[model samples]
Target chain A: MTQPSEKALVPFVSVDNMMRLVHHIGLEEMLKDLADYVEEDFRRWELFDKTPRVASHSDVGVIELMPTSDGEAYGFKYVNGHPKNTAEGLQTVTAFGLLADVYTGYPVLLTEMTILTALRTAATSAMAAKYLAPKGADTMAMIGNGAQSEFQTLAMKAIIGLKTVRLYDKDPAATAKCAENLKNSGLTVVSCASPQEAIEGAHILTTCTADKQYATILSDNMVGSGVHINAIGGDCPGKTELAKGILERSDVFVEFPPQTRIEGEIQQMPEDFAVTELWQVISGIKQGRTDARQTTLFDSVGFAIEDFSALRYVRDKVAQTPFHEDLDMLADPDDPRDLFGMVQRAKP
Target chain B: MTQPSEKALVPFVSVDNMMRLVHHIGLEEMLKDLADYVEEDFRRWELFDKTPRVASHSDVGVIELMPTSDGEAYGFKYVNGHPKNTAEGLQTVTAFGLLADVYTGYPVLLTEMTILTALRTAATSAMAAKYLAPKGADTMAMIGNGAQSEFQTLAMKAIIGLKTVRLYDKDPAATAKCAENLKNSGLTVVSCASPQEAIEGAHILTTCTADKQYATILSDNMVGSGVHINAIGGDCPGKTELAKGILERSDVFVEFPPQTRIEGEIQQMPEDFAVTELWQVISGIKQGRTDARQTTLFDSVGFAIEDFSALRYVRDKVAQTPFHEDLDMLADPDDPRDLFGMVQRAKP
Candidate 1:
């Protein structure tokens, strides 16, 4: 029998190419679909090998590598968080990731993760909100409006029918930009002077600030009885958003306990702090938003599995479109031992 | 900041492009230069934040992510080890890696590691041989010639003056092919049968087998005094080369102990096994090859820092070359926060 034809190569989505994928798919469809992938991956959380990311701390920022494997597939992302970056006209965090076949170790996809991370973070927030927020909740109060502001706004609109958004930032220009972008998106946008005004009568509170120290954005006195706090900023050992009083009094939820205890809002709490993993809630192993008046909080430190899901989703979507490019990811030698021969053959 | 100019985009070295780089650099000089980088990094080992790689294990093989950072630069490699892949016409191990600016988390270089790894590993072995082997070493006994054979041969020639090489493989055809390729390299090559025949009087003994088990390629009795044994196989948990008596009788050196303890030939030893780190020797903190009468072993398990050096070298070399491609690896928005707006503009 003749040898089988060579398999089609894997597609790659670079940073520019991924933005085009987002433009082609439309942000709303991408976020709504990404949330589904996140939810589904969370439901099968037991199938994955999970670990807190490996981080290298510097005087200015912390660079980290997050990796995970689902037996047959493997993925990892390289990311950095430097709040001082924006002053230099750079992103606070820029990232990229790779997807590989576990059995052969060939990288099938490599894509820019700056935009993708923002998209996945928002999708993950909306995903947790779907389970922890009161059904039919349509208004969100987003504090710390910066690069991540629009993503949260779009995800809320796409996944939960969010119709009104109240925005707040220490910088007024950020809030103005957020409000301006929300125009004609079928959402009523309001700019708030302070965190107190942003939270007034809103169904969800999303905090995506870029501070590395413990500075409470929300106090016990400001939280409503039934509001869901989507805490995304307090994600390092000493960084936090909610005061200890708020966390001690609310129904707390987190992504991974081992990591959340050290990086999420619970990082401010005692090591024995009580919390539930989002997967537990998704699996129905535990209850979420038990009563209409009970408060809920999702401490998002950004897990590896979320990136895994997002990479796979974008990897699939971009392949079907012409937006993706091909990356040189592995070396295929006729005789594996002849690595030198491969170079020799290229000689002029 | 007139749109940050598309010309500023970071370029990527895909598998196809990386192969071109190796071919352009030529095998001998590439290995020689890679060894220089590895040697340089090892000299400044204290500057880097290092950790043992994080791995996910499966029945077939294991996949690992190795990450390291030197405050300003960050790097990681994705690699796998599967001894049975040759039956399927695949390399027993395949890999790829990236190097990024730690300050911005922007990946500046995305490269193929399958060929690069072979280059680095051989350079590393040749590096250790430089320090631990007898100063006048010119003949090397190579056993289990497979995917990594050519790399080992060339690296030894480039770094350690390996003018005579005795080759042995389970498949005689593999040994024959290795000799054919090195016909014009100004080296004397020999094809031998059995580990005993290959090791007769060579000054260096290199076992680069791909079997992922504990089978001994060379027994302690076969090792001559003053010969440096470069153990290239047995990188993961259940694999090794020299028998227990061999390590027990020799001064075993390693790349990183915590990692080598789990993946190197020394894994068969006790947790308290005393092995000098190669960096110490490179840094002049520890003695290497104290006497020709002593049997020495270099336990080689690849490290992430070496990849960092290789990546930096390739990136610098590519920047000087005329044959390079742009990959658009960054997402620098006119306003960084307007990543969402980029999607809107990408539309016709």
Candidate 2:
């Protein structure tokens, strides 16, 4: 029997392939590109179908599913966050994602999302600050400067034009490491002792603490007016960051309301609490920060569309540059009906 | 410098390894063992954390996420059903899944679920038949026999003592293909012309049609009293197999009620419509087939726990075999904080 000439399956982006792309492109340029992808997707929001993320929680950590579609393609990310894992020598977060064609339901790409997720999270923050923060915001106070700190600095510098960084972590070694990494980048980097000192006079306050409990990283007194608060931690049920007062004072914008409501700072507020979707702001369908003195809060719990956008960017880059391995994952059968034939034909 | 020890990396069960497993165990033994695994998992349903599958719908088809945990471990499957693709010469459904350690939140096994899915779906049906059908029930009318027919036949013979299967499909070629595949089995097979002729005098009725639209493969008038209906195909927003009368007349059993409300025959009913959970029945918390002469329905839209059960089974079996591949998907640094070192240490 003759088989129809089928379209060649796309190459899969693996963990090493993605790392090579980052190394080749330079992390700053890649983060900026990823930021651009997020901004571009957010601007054309109406062309996509959006939904809140679904999560399954346990005592140690949580596994989440974030799914979105750009009308033509569908994507989702599976990520797990276990803060204590760092002590056990495992990264706090590990992820993988899939991109499928909506027309044919064929999975076009499956890529390691660990590094991609880090880049996208930082990119999303930078994208949000572009419209939500004051124009030409220069200095960012990064609280809890750990594994995610450098990416945020790179993204903000490459995308939002940051010139200075103030770092603070409960562990002084982490702050020293952050400072050492940013020492020769031509940007002025300062190590602070307390959260209060970190946020004294910064244009953006990025809180990405890794604590799994409801601990307040930022109080109302520390956050000044006109600063964009990028709340990245407190993304699960019982985990939270910013004090209730910050949420009350700021104009909060979220990726998806239903999801951020449960995972973001809004979890502390009533269900009727008002918020703006970042896509709406990007699409110009809704307003962002109303004035210069208005404190804007981007309560980001990370959405799937950003990951989808990131995946597309990585897939495109992988094609242009010679980096990637075919995963040998998809079962390509000669006869679609005879999936069992694959086993029967295999040589022992 | 020496590369970090490989103790942190997780093992991957690639499609090649899965095919090798099927060849080593042989299809019949694998089907029978998978059926036992599913049956055992169902009986201990109360021990599992069950939730409705999350579904994302599109104009072309629907993609769904099915996740479950048994306190000890968690598993999830990413599956898509685009029935129209077969006409376009693509498989109607394709899937892959992961089984993770709930305590540590690390993926212990990742397996190609396309072929395994076919094996498990048929096994689940036979398991349902074993409990719901009468003591001497030896015949089943399999309507819409396509990719799933042979496994259904073999699983029934292996698990439920089904000695005969009256097969019928709108396409005569499909019916012939099914008979040809199952010719050596002990069960006597008959290819019928229509749904009405197929179900006539049969002890059990199973429907596994593949369409994204509402398809009434079994009508109200065609079903007889004391018949156990295993409805397997109607698994998305607009897809359904049984007539409304069939659902109303039968004692309906379902896999997670919220999910069944969206994907099964019960989707046509209201939010408050009554249905018994198959898990509850299997756990003896509720009853299965309350009456000997009353019609009963197993609205099997497919559940995550069964996949979880199968994943555990496959992962355990694969661990015992030499066929394995190292995906190298995880990022491990001697110090988890030295993520930056990963790039610097890469031997370019």
Candidate 3:
């Protein structure tokens, strides 16, 4: 039987390759590059075909398919979130994604997105902080120092010139892990005993606890008037990290309103609560950080466009690189109608 | 960095491996096995999580993600349909699928489903015919003999004891290719000039034309009483095969009404049009082929559960076999909360 052609092959970046790719391009530089891609896609967000992620919720966790297309390329991520997984020695979130050409409906790249999701989620937070954080902001209060804390702190350092990260988690071991991971990353990592102490003198307050219930990791009293809140953990319904009072006091910015209304911290807010679309803010059609004393909150639920940007970034960077292996994922018959003949010829 | 643990590896069946596996098991035998799986799943269809496939349609083609879970395992197929692709020497339809453990949210198997889809689609049609087709049915009129024709014929032969296949296509070359491919498959092959001629002595008529627009391949007058119609071509909004009159004459059976109502031959019917769920018949809740002179139509748009069944079948069949390779598709950090540490340790 003849070998499959190039068109039939899809470049797959494994977790090992993804980590190698991250190191190949310095981690700090890669985070900044990803932030740029996220910002770029947000600028033209109207062109994307957006849909609320289709999710299958079970008693244990949730599996979701987030899909979006830009008329030229289509991308989607298959991600599962099981908060109980961490107790079982597994990552709470594991993901992989595919990018396909819109013209031919053929996959061009397939890659593990577990590491990429961490990078993109943090980069998106940092990018939002770039616009919403106070001018000359350099300190961030990193609450819930877990898997995402190090990336979040490093992204802030790379994108917004953050010089210090104040880390605090209910589990001190998690805070220690985040602090140790970022110790040599050029940021002054300070381990704090409490969330209140972590927010001291910080310009950005980021919360990313992994509890599956509505836990108030941050209260209204803990947040200062001018500090920007990057809330990334309240991604699913009933999984919020901030108190409802905190949401009422700030101007909430969201990815997609219909989705954010269901999954973001705004799920606690009334349906009529006013919020700004982040794309409009990025495009300069709407205001962002107008006053030094006004609180600006990025109620991020990690939209599909962000993942599309990340997928596109990896696809472009992996071109002609050793970071990917081609898998014969598509069937390419000499005659499109002779698929049976192709299979018959491969009788070995 | 240390090597990823077993939990991070996913078994992947490439196209070559898939073809080898098919040949290893014998195509006819494998088709029969797949039919049994499809039928087995159909019996418990109500236990599945069903949703209309998430589709992203562009001017030229469409990309879709069909996902479902049966409480224990989650499965999804990434498929695309670009009718113009055949002109560029590419298959009009291509697919790949993944099956993940619902408990850990970790993928167990990933496989190229282009060939598998052909096999499962045919198997599903034959499985439906087992319950809907007349007893002692021997000949099948295979119309629009393209990529799916030969599989449909073989599946019918293997699952329903079909002895002869009469082929017809708008393009004679397609019919010729299908006949040539099936010449050695033990079934008597008959090539015909018209669709009418193909059905002269056939007990079952299968239409699988490739047109993206509504083109009636079978008029009402051409469909005789008591003959079973297996329509597998009209899978999108503007695509269909059989005439509206034929649907009116036949008792239509569908996989999922919400999906088939928009993509199947029933799309031409009213929103309130009467149709039976094929699963009900499989579970013995509804009658199949009620009378000798009653027409039965299986409007198969292809559902997520069927793909789920096919994925389960492959994962089971490929176990302890050399038909698949392990893919490092997920990131398994030693400490679930120390993903950054994992990446940092991998800096080579």
Top-TM-score candidate index: 3
Compared with the true structure, what per-residue lDDT tens digits does model 3 show for residues A1-348?
559999999999999999999989988899999999999999999999987789988888889999999899999999999988988888889999999999999999999999999999999999999999999999999999888999999999999999999999999999888888887888888999999999999999999988888999998788889889999999888889998888998988999999999999999988989999999999999999999998999999898999999999999999957999999999998888889999999987
Clashing pairs in 2: none
Better of 1 and 2 by DockQ: 1
Give per-residue CA lDDT, model 2, range B177-220, as digits (tens): 78877777778999999888888778889898776689888888
The CAPRI classification for model 1 reads as medium
Worst 10 residues of 3 chain A by lDDT: A179-188
lDDT of 1 by residue, A90-206 (tens): 777777788887877666787878889989999999999988998778889999887788889989999988988999999898888878777868899999999999998799999
Classified by CAPRI criteria, candidate 2 counts as: acceptable
- Best candidate per DockQ, number? 3
- The clash numbers for all candidates, in the given order, read 4, 0, 0
Tell me which of candidates 1 and 2 scores higher on lDDT. 1
Superposition error at B285 for model 1 (Å): 2.4
Q: What DockQ do you compute for every candidate structure? A: 0.52, 0.39, 0.83
Model 3 chain B worst lDDT window (10 residues) = B83-92
lDDT of 2 at A156: 90
Worst 10 residues of 1 chain A by lDDT: A1-10
Residue B115, candidate 2: C-alpha displacement in angstroms = 1.2
